[model samples]
Target: MSAVRLISNHTLKLQPQRSSSQLFRRHASSSVAEGSFTARRGLYASLLLLSTGALAAYYFDSRAAIHRYVLTPVIRHILDAENGHKLAVRVLASGFAPRDTQSDDERLKVQLWEDELSNPIGLAAGFDKHGEAVDGLFNLGFSWVEIGSVTPKPQPGNARPRMFHLMDDTAVINRYGFPSDGHATVLARLRARFPIFYQEGSEPHASLRSNALLAVNLGKNKTSPVESADDFVSGIRAFGSYADVLVVNISSPNTPGLRALQSHALLEDLLGRVTHALDEIATSESNKSRRPKLVLKIAPDLDEAQVDDIAKAILQKSVDGVIVSNTTVRRPSTLTDANKAEAGGLSGPPLKPYSLATLRMLRARLPAAVPIIGCGGISSGADALEYAKAGATAVQIYTSFGYDGVGTCRRIKDELAEALSREGATWMETVQRASAELSLKPEDRSAHTSIAQLTKEAEELMRLVDELGERVGGADPSKDNSATESTGVLPVVSNGTERSDFVLFSMANARQWVILDRSDNAASPCIFATLAYEAIDQGAQVASSNSKGRTISGTLMYRRGQLLERIPRHAEASEKLYLDYKIKPTGDKDKKLIWAIA
Candidate 1:
């Protein structure tokens, strides 16, 4: 009976163990199921956030409140500047940037090169270092989208921390050194774009877009010889057919000796080679007129003489246009940013003055046919207008675009349009007017007499006058008695062979007065004689003539090139007068003398 009871207790214990084991299994299964469900929920939530973010990026305009208050701040705070720039480029390439919805007003249209651009606003080169974002930038409403400081070979460019933001000055400084994706890569991309762009019902060729143009800014590789034209020539051959304009970028300060290309000899060689390459491309093309316009981009730090040299080279080389200017190494005192001392080219408001001055100087030297594109420190429509007034056919924005965002082009266009309307003008009209008014006119550019030349001529004239005076003053008063009937003065008129007029007076102090008449011939010989007669009548001292005739002794004042013989102290010396001329006749039979001011 004890054995039977123990067996029953064992069975009872086994039953409880089985029930507890089943309960534990159920709990484990339930926990696994809940864990899997939670993970799936988290993944869905993440996907939703990503989709929302992508949508916001694509749909929102760069000018939207979210972009200004949120997106911009987020980008600036989250990423380093150079990386942020990369990210922006990537975003644009991905077609996530907002589309330019606004069409330009008719008044905003302008002509650059042979094309008629929808607006005068354009994106300058440095903004797009590669051809990766040409169409992307164009989508943002830039009529002219310039790409690449493209080199013949790939280059990393400068070093880390090479770019800085001067937030206080709304500027940027960069030592990018023309980082480019070589000619091969850039040319391949452009070639790809070319076919698609010109296809039926596709985006128009950059040249076909009226005033819209696509330009490639060619740069020399850091390791390449600075003076060699091979790199730029290669670039022209590679991209000549694909671009509307080809910009030879020899102006970047970051490059060790790139700016040296601005030297007359080097620039001549560079442009000549590039032009030859362009001609070759044009010759190969079925359409002869479809060649790219060649432009030269120069630095803002150039002096007047340097700029003049560049202008001469441009005219000599037959370059199509010039972009007046790239960044400057100069740091203005007005720069309040700590980055002011950074070692790189300075750009933004500090650059405006330098650029405008350079542009004005360049305009005065360049012919009206070659247009100048003004760049540097332009942030507003007013600034664009200022550039126009200074003789720019078109204006480009760079530092301002970087600081402000993609909406910069649109904003500038709006502002420019409004200003143009206020003046009852169009962009074409304003540019035309500015070009006509400010550019060097043919008359102003004509050969002028240098001060040295004028001085030399004046000295020669005075010497001749002195010899003539001796001839007249030493003559016998008795011989010319018939000629001295009126006031005992002889009137000598320059013969008809001369273009200039002059008068000679004999003074009592043994000094002869030579009136250099630089006036028009309206003053007849009779009038000139009256001047000498009037001086004697004004209590004038004279030499004692043996024939009882008096010789006038006093200074003669030529007022406004009109001969006025006056007694000493009769007129203030401060009066605006030509230089004094003294002459004593040398007894020459031809008493007529000529006066030449220049």
Candidate 2:
């Protein structure tokens, strides 16, 4: 009886339980009349039908809106809506011209050809001069790719049909100038599809993200030449944060007076400002643990003074890197791009030597610590080897990538690896070493070494002076010049009545020296003859010290007769020697000795 009673009560409570949210709400108004009692029921059914239709309409409308805005743009880009395919076609055509098509056997033979044949190749900035098909170039296999001379503003570049494909020469003549998609748009596209290296066992991305190494080249759209430095700095700041490396492209011949920025004052000012900006970004990024490299892409035609000045600036500002040799306005005596006669920088076969020369030249100007990424005129492995051997830290190929297909990078990597193994060096070490051996042609090497050379030479000269002193009793004590002014000094003498000699030694590298005055102490055996530089007390005790607080052990090399007689009757009387030192103030903390002046 209790169980039956509980069941009845639970059923009663379960009547029509109300929902937390809107559900079974009462109608706001009654429906219009239909015909009779049956008509009223029919009207209620009609209302339900209308409500369902209204809700379905709203859903379709919302979906349509989403499709129109969000989905369309992304799809359009993926589909190459902005004529993006042309970029691929152009890059393919420009990079691997002449051989619009190549046989498999010929492709296989390229790597064995040599460094001068391929490695570091060229892609003149304005080639795509418009931000078209960078993706296509990557697919063809370039170790690295450079795209755009993107400006702060959009530009159409020179004129229509400014790009000329020279079939015979296997090169393209582009006076397209620097067409750009502006800073914001291109950068946004690049960000969304940011490239990643598709290596073995690498983390995956959303879809077909690029595996190629990226370098985004920014250029001045149309220079207000007076504000050149400001333009470059702005370019650097705009794209400087996200790129793997930022290139300050003051070397483009297309922009008026752009090359003049290569002048010492202008170049230094520009590079100094740009690198400082890169560093600030680097520091902020380091906290996040990522930073872009800064590199300057210079022209091939710069004179030695210009190149030296650029190197001097790099050393002064401590720039991240440099890229040698861009396309040349100077035409080579060749026949590939007969239209090459058109007024534009000549690239392809003729540009190879010039580009390589620039690499060798820039290598000489920059310090070993500073890396040079050699580009331009490389169409084969031989070309790559030349750039590698010429002293580039890494090489980027553009034009040849277009011709070669995606296999280019793989082939070049294999060839470069072989070259490195044959030479018994790692890739980087190979460049540095091979560069030392390259007999730079006049065009490739700079003749000037002002600031850097002067500083190093002066230091070496000072070391020689010190070396000469030990051999011939020190530089005439009269020559107290500004030579030691820069670094700290320990004064040995100040009092007018007597002068004390002092030597403060610093060991930064290897050096050699031999003490003179052998006749002064014939009985004393050679204590540190093989020392080569720093004298060692082979078998002597530190008995006493002279001035300047440096204690050294040596038998009497000079002394009075009485002092010598104290040693042995047979010993020379004029022998005298003393470990050098000076009395120190009790307050100083780092002193090693406490010899008192007696």
Candidate 3:
């Protein structure tokens, strides 16, 4: 009985040990499985973080190849032309747009008016018609951001499908018809861009960037009379204080009868009123110190006569600058895209020839003082350089910006810098040289007599001035030490001393004259006559002649209380003169200075 009981106890103990061994093995297996799962989770988390960082880096880099190759293509494929534009503006306004991380090359710097731009590349007006994405566009490295074809009142523009993309041709056509958010809405957006501690005097640029500019493109409302200048005048009043330049848009083919304003008579009236309004704004207390420059935007479809007439109006009204062209209504044979049949202005590679032709024609007629901003189908640095060679002070792009995505500005700038370096010239230098070569000279006149005839007339006028000086100041005509025999013009002096009233002299060509005020308290020391001596001769009555056949009966008309000093005198004529002076008629109050024959 004792042996049987001991056997049962041993069997029970053995069973319990077996159970313990199995339990130990199960725990070890479970631990191993948990460790492997944890390692996989860690690997996945690390991969996720790495991928996120890489994406962020790519998105921020303006020159990232992925933008041009992947993102832009995807967006374009997903959205239609108008939708894509809207999305772009929204993205930019939302501050998610890619930025240009690189600093502009020294070769890209351009001096325009009173400001120096970081680069010559600029975004044209149509891209941000409502002024919603000024800062974002600037982020892409555009030195000039022109917002709006903003009308006096809000407009819905044409119907849907108004915008078309010709992918094959690399062009776009739109009939937006000056669709705008109106002057007030756009003005609010511009004002909101100002910083918390904004000071107008400290930052003079409307763009709010030191090396950039903001321009407002003014367009007329379709509901209003096409012949009236009221809308444009109102635009100047509304945005004049907020913009560096005010573009008068009279060229959009989308707007009915808008092109009519470019006619000779209509243009004259329009420019006259516009300049008057600008002057009023300039003289106002709010903008007395600084006023926005006035620029005229014209169409690409103008004929030679139309271009000539436009140039005449620009010179006659003293328009500050000119934008060479807007979009064209014509279609090129090279356009194979199905959307080519759409009726609207065409822009892109095809429009280059027309824009270039118009630019060359107008550039030849206008003086260099009037800068031309070329806008057309410029897709690369070579394209921009072509415009620069044709006398464009700066160039603006639209269709290319639409097709090429955010990296467009950076890419073009890089290409332009390389091209300029290869040529060993800066943009400004190139433009200056081109302009000097292409533009008309002061001596060119189909109606006026030859320079030799004018020179003879000037010499005769100088002899008359010598006799007049002798009669007035009682100084011998020949004994005056300041008289220049080579120039054949006598300097106005009192008893061989510089006179305080004014000094009058004729240029060797007799086409120009100079007036100097030597008074101790004179505000300006020099004043140049703008009208040619031939005009003076034709208008003035020859009252009589002195014993020496010298006549001093002509009248000199000049703007009153206006002074222009430090004119660089002609190098060949007078060594004493340090500067040349230019005088333009302000169309304001005039005072005549008359010298009578004795």
Candidate 4:
């Protein structure tokens, strides 16, 4: 009985010890699982934080590599060219667009008109067709943000699929045809940007940013009269108060009869009326001190005659600047993209040669006083530099910007800065030097010579004039005669008629003669005789005398052996000259210039 009880007690004790060990194992397993959960939570939190930081950095930095290598490519691949452009504008307009955080290098700094730009880089007009993303684009480091081809009335523009991407060629073809929200809508958007307590200062820019400018590109409505400047005039009057620059966009290939306005007579009328409207605006109380500059946007397809006509109109109308050129209608053989056959204006790498050639030709024709803004297929810093060396005051980009995304402006500026640093030159300095060296000299400006070769016929005529003057008992051709040295009288016979009432006057500045008829009831009262003198290299100076010995002075430009007088409005005899002769007006009220073919 003693042995049996000892065995049973041992069994019970072993059972209790086994149960306690089981509880301990369960507790150990629970602790390990809890520890693993805590470790996983920590790892997940770390990953989230790291990813958030990385995304923030990438989102803020416009120069981030991901934008160029990944995001831009993905966007280009996913969306059609038109949709992609819309989405970009939407993002920028949403104020979520990445900003260029870096400051522009000093070498890239350029002066445009009265304002100083942080850089010479500019965004072209067609990008922000409705002024929807002006500030957003400015955030991307563009010093000049041009918006709108805004017409007087709203229009839907061309059909869908109007924008095409030439991926292989790095080009874009678009025929949006000035799709806009009209002048009223765009003006409201611009005006809404003003501060609540805004006050007009002595010098306020349209951009509202000290280093930037806002240019409004004005386009006529498709249904409007293509030959009229009324639409452009209305645009100026509406937006002139708010815009820093007003661009007359008459070069879009999509618009019918739009290019016809570029013809000599039509351009003269268009520029004349627009300039007159600007003058009226400038003299108004609202725009007393500030006058928005006028810029002409031309196409790249203009021939030599068309270009010369354009230049003449620009100079005559006193336009502030020109944007050389818009998208090209000509298809280059180098374009290998499937969309190359698209019937729209082509813009991209293929446009570079046409645009650059046009820019060079225009620069040579325009004087230094008028600045030329280079546009069309300017994608790289080298392209911008090439424009600068070719006398472009500034450069604009569109297709490259579309293909490259928000980083384009920064990339181009960086490239240009690097190039300028290597050359030890600034953008403005290069442009100024090129302009001075390449621009046409005063004496060399011949209407015919600009297009065709100059004939030796002018030299022969000049010699004939000298021989005729000597035979008429005039003073020696070699002597520089002052008006005071002569009797103010010259007897000359023309067509077997002797006129004793002809008086001689020497123009002090131009060294040319002015022959005024003192006879009463003469059919042609004023005769300007171009006397060939060895010292007369400058343009002719015109003068006329009244009864009180008062003198009227003006400039006479030599155009292919013919004299075109630029009559001074301040001259006392200007009204009489216009009324008596019924001079052909240039359509501007401020212009008193008359054309005399002889």
Comparing 1 and 2 by lDDT, which wins? 1
Give the lDDT of residue 349 in candidate 1: 84
Model 4, CA-based lDDT: 0.72
**Colliding pairs, model 4:** none
Full ranking by lDDT: 3, 4, 1, 2
Model 4, 1-598: lDDT tens digits are: 1122235546522222346677799999999999999999999999999888767756677877777888888988999888888888998998887888898898887888898899999999988988888889999999999998999999999988899988889998898888889988998888877786554324478788999888999999999988999999999899888889999999999998899999977886687678767767777776677789999999999888788778767775678899999999999888888989989899988898888888888887877778999998898999999998888999999889888888899999999999999999998899889989977544422332221111232222233233323222233557653331221222344444544433333323233333433322111212321111100223423333233222223344433322233222211122233333322221221111222111
Model 2 lDDT tens row, 1-598: 1122235546633345446343323321222222365787888899999867754432323222333344334443464312433544563545332121221121222221112222333343544443455555544444345667778888777766655545567665666567788888866655555445422112221113333345678787674664466666676666654455567787777667777877866665566456555555545533234445667888888777777777655654456678876778887766644586777666666677787777777776554556677777666566677777777756666555444433445555556566656756655456657655552322211322233432343353354334333222323445653344113221122132211112122212212111211111212111111111112222333443334332332332211111111222111111112112221211111211111111
lDDT of 1 by residue, 1-598 (tens): 1122235546622222346677799999999999999999999999999878866664655555555566766887788879888887887888767767778889988777666778888889987788887778888888888998999899989888899988889889999888888999987877676555363223335434555799999988888887898888888888776788899999999999999999976775576567666766766644355778889999999987798668766764567899989999998889998988889999888899999999999998766788999998999999999999899989999888777777788888889899989999988888788788777664331232243433343444444433333233453433532232111222333322222333333333223444433332212222333445444444333432222121223333333333344322211110111112221111121222232111
Give the Å shift of residue 133 in candidate 2. 5.1
| C-alpha lDDT of residue 45 in model 2 | 92
User: How accurate locally is residue 161 in candidate 4, as Cα lDDT from 0 to 100?
Assistant: 82
Over 212-272, each residue of candidate 3 has an lDDT whose tens digit, in order, gives 9899999999998988999999998888878889999999999999999999767866766
Better of 2 and 3 by TM-score: 3
> Model 3 scores what on Cα lDDT?
0.73
**Model 3 quality (TM-score):** 0.73
TM-score of each: 0.65, 0.52, 0.73, 0.75
TM-score of 2: 0.52
Compare candidates 1 and 4 on TM-score and give the better one.
4
TM-score leader: 4
